[model samples]
Target: MTQQDAQTKPLTVDAVMARSGVQFGTSGARGEVVAMTDQVCHAYTTGFLQHLAGLGEFSPGMRVAVAGDLRPSTPRIMAACAQAVRDLGGEPVFCGFVPTPALALYAFGQGIPSLMVTGSHIPADRNGIKFYRPKGEVLKEDEAGMRGQVIATDPALFDDAGMLKAEAPLPEVTEVARSYIQRYVDHFGPQALRGLTIGVYQHSAVGRDVLVEVVEALGGKAVALGRATQFIPVDTEAIRPEDVELAKGWAAEFGFDAIISTDGDSDRPLLADHTGEWLRGDILGVLCARALRAHAVVTPVSSNTVLERSGAFAETDRTRIGSPFVIAAMNAHLAKGEQPVVGYEANGGFLLGTKLGSLEPLPTRDAVLPVLTVIVASRPGKIRDLIEELPPRVTYSDRIQNFATEKSEAIFAKLLEGDKDAQIVRLNEHFGAIAGAVTQLDLTDGIRMTTEQGVIIHLRRSGNAPELRCYSESDTVEQAKAINEQALAIVRDKLA
Candidate 1:
């Protein structure tokens, strides 16, 4: 059966919720396709626009650009959202089948608010909606307000027929993509990457060819490999061992400097060196910051502290682990003329310095910019050599036992109440005594604690998935592994 037919048939709210797993995350709204039907998507999009209009957030004739990734279900979701925008009395400009960064660029170019329908590297069955104000991402409070309106409003109000009647034509605007490509070229300058051969694994990414174009535009040969019809959801944060072998073989055969790829949507990047070792995302972010010699660098708390140790950034700022939080922090710094040259995530996406004058594009996390920095900075040696020259530190991340939605929320709420006496006491008693005192504790994203031995432990329920992620960092690989094991054991005891 077609998606539209399935969505039109009656389904209970409980069933929908069970299927969708709709819950709040560090980003925006996310859920499975079964739960996020055309009806639900239409309602949420309509409500968000209505909320913005009611608050005088957008002008009556203001344009609202929309885009999506290459998800099989994205086309229908995009159509529903377009209709919803029209129903709310805003012009809908459709940039069909583009990356998240592309949509952000389009919105910035049009000087209008926008939205992107994607789930990043999540499973194929999952999807999400990210809203952008003219300035940048929508705030958490604004997201909550929009969700409230969606829940309170009636879905029938945004039916297909009513939406069609309200439809208004939006001018075609593909030049925004070209403009963004040129922005990268201009920032790095022509021939910045002279004499570099880069291999791009185009495994069904929506922006696969775009990545190649950007690389070649900057004076590099891009060897495309592993082109696939089915979407390969690459978690750039965590590259599988098999993919690492494949990348190594390709790099050796092609005699390339580095291998570059992105997740399904091309928002996050994955890179492999000539030696065939997959570079971790956090390492890439730090390396890029070092290359640019950023005056002030902003990153998520989940990132490695290597940036501080590398002496590349004069000041380092940490935010909760999401692009929106990082972007917000970057915007705040720019307002004070701090001129943050770089902002990035542990997931291999880097934001360049803000562009000024004549409706400049806001610097959001992007995969292309970071990949380019890595390529330009590397010497004749493999990418791994450049990484080894840095300070010695190892970071490890793995999810603890998975939990149901209600259970995960309950655990986080308890942690936020500052009942540390009971919680900390029980944790110490369960995990045995350590050598150093609990030097610092933070609850920005989750419960993160550090020890004097240079071991760091961060525990938080995954905002996007059902798992609880526990990250550890130490001076050595073995030490990091031990800390990760101990942290997971402690979590298992507590949750049990």
Candidate 2:
């Protein structure tokens, strides 16, 4: 090696993240797989532990739990986390490929911190590590804390390309897959799903096997279908057209009581009715909370407004987009002594704020709970009936990827300038008019403009990936879909 090369200093965690295109989103740190080199992951983990240590979360010989999804990049990223744990004087407990909530439940039970290597439902090329506190998910405050920490690494451990020179095998770890299964079995009992023919559409999700196990354990005849070996990025928030058609065809041909599935990591749920039409996620959250008898429910502004209009809960709370924001709001409700506090995202990932019976406390998003709860709540009816019972508000969402964040923010800023009348005129000029004039504008997470005719148009940047999302709502489903489709195309062309 050259003398100057030997003297080259290693980059700090923040610097590495900045250069590698990895950054903290609403939930976790995510980036392309190439940017998530072993050294970069190690620096990220080291910074996380340092942040936790600042909060008195770790010490010498302290135990830290680790888990991963089935993504190809997961094992490598986890190995990096294990190495970091070793260097920080902490013991790493390896919990092989499991749902994010399953690992979280085990870690929170042990009163130790844990890290999950999964990108949730994003594309396979992108992945992230979700950090957990002893109590629950790390709040937004914790993300800020990690960003300020200084992380240093040994120069000898990495090559000139910044990748780990040698790979370290995972440590001896416990398998908590059964424990997570037992969690649902104990709470709902063996016959909660009796006489129900649940179709498990097993994609390449990490939780596919677990989904089948839990359903069968509950006396539900789980018919597995479409199990895939390669990872398929199934966005529960934005169900693909083909998936919708397939679920509908299967439900009609197979006579399924319901079709249950989840995203890539099985955090956010995707459920379809007996006739094969998928239900919206916010509706799932409402039904699940109702089943649990939760007096208060927390969700984000992007969720359906039917949560409030339906008058289902004693208290309803809204936050900015993301689980951290929803969980934080749920925490506030807990301080008020609200029992059975539960929260969920627009993607239908349920969070239990407090322990409910045999179910341990898991404040992280879980695809399984909402699936079971919504199915059980449908007692003598169908998933479609439970949804049809709700108010007639329909929501449609779509995104334009690779849309620069600066471009998205700039467009919103420009449209939101001047008077409201001027804004509507500009919008109508660009993409025609919404149903009616703008009556209200919500700037909670993004800019949600509600028209006098009860149409809602929400435009926001995706928290996880590089994209701009548009969510629209109307009394009719077709209009809702059309409104969003039109808006997104306009944004795409304008930005392009």
Candidate 3:
């Protein structure tokens, strides 16, 4: 086709996804950086705007906030997205290299749509674009809407490799960073963390410096450690072995009250206690909810059962594993006029669904809130003391990388072939040696089976990549790890 014809012809989001090998994952559009060319990124941004426009959340000449992580590809992707905003007759407000939540907060406060260029905890070679409506994250329906869009673009704007011929320079950084830091300082008070010594792990996370600022502003002596120049894919759910040792060393060396860090975009958090023991995300969620005095709590089914067993909240709900699902459940309670509703994930990303005294509800995964809350709530005693107060439930998770999704599906199909009794029999046959007889099964998001001995084992395929994840909960940490190891071994052997 001629250039003019190509410029006029519209492209469907699905078609672009197929052609470029970039598709929406659990949270956003993700793929290898090489697959996410300027043309592809532009098309996605345009499609997102088109979908939001239909919902009356976007319009021409309106401002759309944009931000990025510290990945090398992020700036280039952000430029493409910003150009698309201009092409769509909307103004692009570059929020600079800020955390995902900071960009969302700024856009929400201004009542404007926004986009973030990040891959979250993924590797640097891969990246993603997370869309946000004026209020919060786009839901499943919004994803459908974006996927169904047909976006028109000018072919002349891009080169043969789909890169922009002349990339538009990103605008000057807005005051988003300052405002985001102030959000915490103003809410928690300057003396909230008084008499505390905290270590902030600044390992190339986009919000590394921001984390330090928050800790110091809250009146804690902040020590920055292991600042990396390159991107480090730190998965909070499966804490890296090196990170675990580093935290232990830092705790012993610095005598820190607590050590805190975040994933690449700073949405998910990593918090280690004085003993260098990192708290699980679900446990952190429970502590944060208690600290905030939340009445209603929502989280993924993959999280520990301690929340329900602790009797801390008046109501609790579980959903499929993902922020969108947790946010949806939180919104459902809010629609019913539930007060002080909150949500979190198994990755330690806390979401506040209801407004507190001076802090507005963010309703997105946040690292700062939980980092501060858990630390403050642990005061008057060490973090270990807070753990002693909780129930005896412990949860552990691990995954098999490069595992085929088809194989995982086959396993699930075989296991879930018959009724509950038959399914239980199948599960027990596989895990009974380590976990005892399967007593109950919960398939909210994955296969969560409870044994006669009260051990819980859950298995699911990763939404973003070809992998099988296993989770286990038991009365002791050793038992949880053993159950997880046994489950992974069984799955691996079956695949073999």
Candidate 4:
């Protein structure tokens, strides 16, 4: 192509998105980084701003905060985003590398729009950008509105390969990070965790440094563990067996009162009790909501059913497995005039629908809020005691990675095709000998079946990747884990 022609060729959002192979998902526009060329990133950012302008949330000269995870590609993505903001006549306030929620909190405090460039629990090779409106997270409607909007990309800021110039410096780190550090400190009060020894698994999360700061700021002795320079994608929904064991080992070795960590973005938390046992995110969600005395709770259908069985909340709403869905349900409760309404995903990212802690309600999932709430609520007691307060139901989850979405749907169709007898036959054919007969079926976000033997099995396509995820629940932990393993084993066999 001629240089002038190339320069004049307008970079449209649709063409860039189509060529880059990146698409919007549960949270943001997630895809492999190789496909997320600077040109594509810049176009998407402009398109996002264009949508915001229509909503009156954005205008020229307004400052938009930006943050990212520890991934190597994040800097360039942030640079592309910053340049886009500049090109569109808005200023990009680079908040350095901070947790997704931390940056969001700062932006919310400033009452301005913001963007976070991180994949969040996805692999390092992949990344995404989550946009925030002035008040809170972008909803499904916002995403839908942004599509099909064509935006021109500037060629000057990019290299010949359509990548941001590496030498171009990011904005000076802002005080927003420090302000976020003090956010928890001021709310929870100093020395809230005094006399407790906490272990932090510093596994390359963007919030690693700030997590330690929060603990220490609260007068809790913070010990850093598993500090890795390499980015580690910690999936809070599907906890790795190694993380489970490491939580225990670290707690026991250091005689920790609790061990805390988060996924790459620090929006989803991982909490281990003194016994070094990792608590499920749903369980943590339950405790956090009850501690805040929330009147209404919204969660995904795939989460642990124990929260309902415990009668912890006055009302419980279940949505599909996505932040957008959860946020939508919370808004519905607001329409009903419910106060202190809250929501959480199975990943343990807590969302406040109403203002709390002297701050306006941040309508996004937050790891620090839940971490602080659980810690303060379970004060002067063991973390496991909080679990004892809840009903005794166990949950387990696993996934068949690289599994095709079509195959998962076909298998489900075959299972749910026939009447009761035929369905049982098909279930057995796939899951071998499950606990008992299928007594109930729920098709909320995916296929969930309740067995007469008090077992629950759920299967759904991963919204963020090419995988089929399965969730199992039972009265006992061992039974729940067994159900998950047995079900995934069947899937693995079929895929093989």
lDDT, candidate 4, at 290: 93
Scored by CA lDDT, what does every candidate get? 0.72, 0.86, 0.90, 0.85
Model 3, position 401, has a per-residue lDDT of: 81
lDDT of candidate 4 over 206-277, digit per residue (tens): 899888999999999999999998998899888888898998888778899989999998999988889888
Full candidate order by TM-score, most accurate first? 3, 2, 4, 1
Taking all chains together, each candidate's TM-score versus the true structure is 0.86, 0.95, 0.96, 0.93
Judged by lDDT against the true structure, how good is candidate 2? Answer: 0.86
**Rank order (by lDDT, best first):** 3, 2, 4, 1
- Total clashes for model 3: 0
Off by over 4 Å in 4: 1-15, 154-160, 164-168, 357-359, 406-429
User: Taking the tens digit of each residue's C-alpha lDDT, what string does model 2 give over 1-496?
Assistant: 2223434754456676677788888878998898888877888899889999999998879999999988899998999889899988999999888888888888988999999998988889999989998878888899888877776657578787666778778977698889899988999899999999988988888888999999999999999989988888899888888899889889988999999999877888988888888888888898898889898899999999998988878999999999999998998999999988999888999999988988877888999999898898888887777887888998888888888778888888887788867776666566446566666777898878887788898989887898899899998989999899878887887744
Please tell me which model should have the higher TM-score, number 1 or number 4.
4
Which ranges of candidate 1 are over 4 A from the true structure? Answer: 1-21, 55-57, 150-154, 157-175, 356-361, 380-382, 400-402, 410-422, 432-439, 489-496
Off by over 4 Å in 2: 1-11, 418-432
Who wins the lDDT comparison? 3
Tell me the lDDT of model 2 at 193. 96
lDDT by residue for model 1 over 1-496, one digit each (tens)? 2235335654433333344566556666678776676666766676567667667777667789888888887877777787667666678888767667878877876668888888877777888878877756777767666755633334444444323223334446444467667877888877876788888888878888888888888887888988888767677765655687889899778887888899877888888887666777888998887776667788999888887888777778899998778877777777778754568888888776565333244576688877777777876566787788779988877764345656767765655455766656444444434425555667788877776676788877778867677778888878776777777776666653
Q: What does candidate 3's lDDT look like per residue over 270-332, in tens digits?
A: 999998899999999999998899899999999999999999899999999989999999999
